[model samples]
Target: MKKLFSFLLLAFMVVNLAHAQQDPQALKILNQMSQKYKSMNAFKATFTQTLENPSAKVKETMQGDILVSGPKYRLAVSGQEIINDGKLMWTYLKDVNEVTITENDAEAESMSPSKIFDMYKKGYKYALAGTEKQGAETVDVIELAPEDRSNPIFKVRLYISQKDKTLKSWQMFRNNGNRYTYSINNFVANPTLASDTFSFNKAKYKGVSVVDLR
Candidate 1:
């Protein structure tokens, strides 16, 4: 489940440079959203994730929380906690009472939580899909298609709040007939986080097993 969550989250860390035929309106909205995120020093958010596979008739929902500060982040979901302090990553699995440590490689094309802020600068084609009313607020919808047809993901959709320029939800459509959705329920911007918030403390988990892959 941890690997699945990570894989799904990383799918959002994809984008491509703008093209001549790119939609200006979509780019404008994306830029605004990116700028708003970049201005934040630290943030915490509670979110819910849903995975549905219509062909297999499988559906599951999970709740999670994330704390991010620059390139460092801590993600907690479904009995697993992943912590990254820019250069190192620690994944603690509660079910097994084990923690795996590894080096953080940004060039690996894998997803990092920080990538969510500026993913629009990567290999994708995007356009403003439409607008909708969500409760009392209006939302701007954007759809993204990967430039590489071989990618497992077929499409990515983003729902941004027009009033606050914040992301409300995102969904990914996979070629395997599976869809993953993430909805932000609560967000606190510029939160005061401790210096060691992204670091893993081995002492706290007394008898936990440690596997260092770095």
Candidate 2:
């Protein structure tokens, strides 16, 4: 679940491909997608995450929502709520009624939400995989591979709408044969956000145990 949440936080990585291995067509689409998201002041999105492991005969699905404003974000998924205020983070477990506070570690986050649309400037090689139909809309499929062979994620596939360049879905394939796919159901650009949106509100979670790890 932690791994799933981490990938969700990173989301999509796009833009600035100077590598010879990178495909020109893919770069153009990625740059456009990056600019589209970068132009937004804040956004809210609802998504569905699907996890599958054929060997283990396991399949699970969860619905979640996220609010992002620059480096700060609030995410609720799979019975867990994570709030990061750019400086600190509060992770609340719904079942246990516990919240753990820790200092935000940017270096530890390989791909932070704020930089999601442009983090592909290094450590990745991407190319245009092809095009496919997503529902009634046609989408351009872009495939991303990590330059570091040691990376657990062997490949990441992104489905971007050809008409608007909006991200429709993305899939991550791990070396262990576990596949994680996330589909964006709804997205609102530049939504009105409250002051406390990126911070955990203990008052709302009555009698919640606080574990300050900072």
Candidate 3:
């Protein structure tokens, strides 16, 4: 009887230990930060995207407020507006005064990677990319490679904050040999939002026609 009890206890402990090792250290931290990224049903923040190619560097500085829910999102820059009400993605270029709408796909590929709350859960594999100290903070570097390498996005490296266990910045490598890097600064969390904010407003832009790209 004593021997049987000891064997069962050992088996239980072994199973728990195995489960603990399932997720890599970096992946575990990323998931925790994802909670903050996932908490707000809708939020608004300023976004700046800079694309660098070998020959030339294109920098686009656009400040926008974003409202996101489930798979739907609506983004409106200072003088521009974009809507994706789950079924269609609408982009209004204020400079050109053109509205482009694209049908939402099952894969949701139209959405940018930074919009992702859970990248690893979407079939991304992560590996440790060593640690580095920046000023007074220690940052953990992690590299994520996609299982399906079909698109221009080949791999991504995330520089995560060690103290807060949050992502600081990420660099995405493209197949064309050009890398895209994005750093999110001054992220604010706003949980209190209206449901209608994510919906499309056709009347607001009376003259703009929805250019269908489906």
> Relative to the unseen true structure, what is the C-alpha lDDT of residue 185 in candidate 3, on a scale of 0 to 100?
53
Global lDDT of model 1: 0.84
In order, the Cα lDDT scores of the candidates are 0.84, 0.84, 0.64
Off by over 4 Å in 1: 1-20, 107-110
Which lDDT tens digits does candidate 1 get at residues 117-153?
5665686788887999878889999888767778787
Colliding pairs, model 3: none
TM-score of each: 0.87, 0.87, 0.71
Is candidate 2 or 3 superior in lDDT?
A: 2
lDDT of 2 by residue, 30-53 (tens): 999988887888889999999999
- Residue 143 local lDDT, model 2: 82
Q: Per-prediction RMSD in angstroms?
A: 6.9, 7.1, 12.5
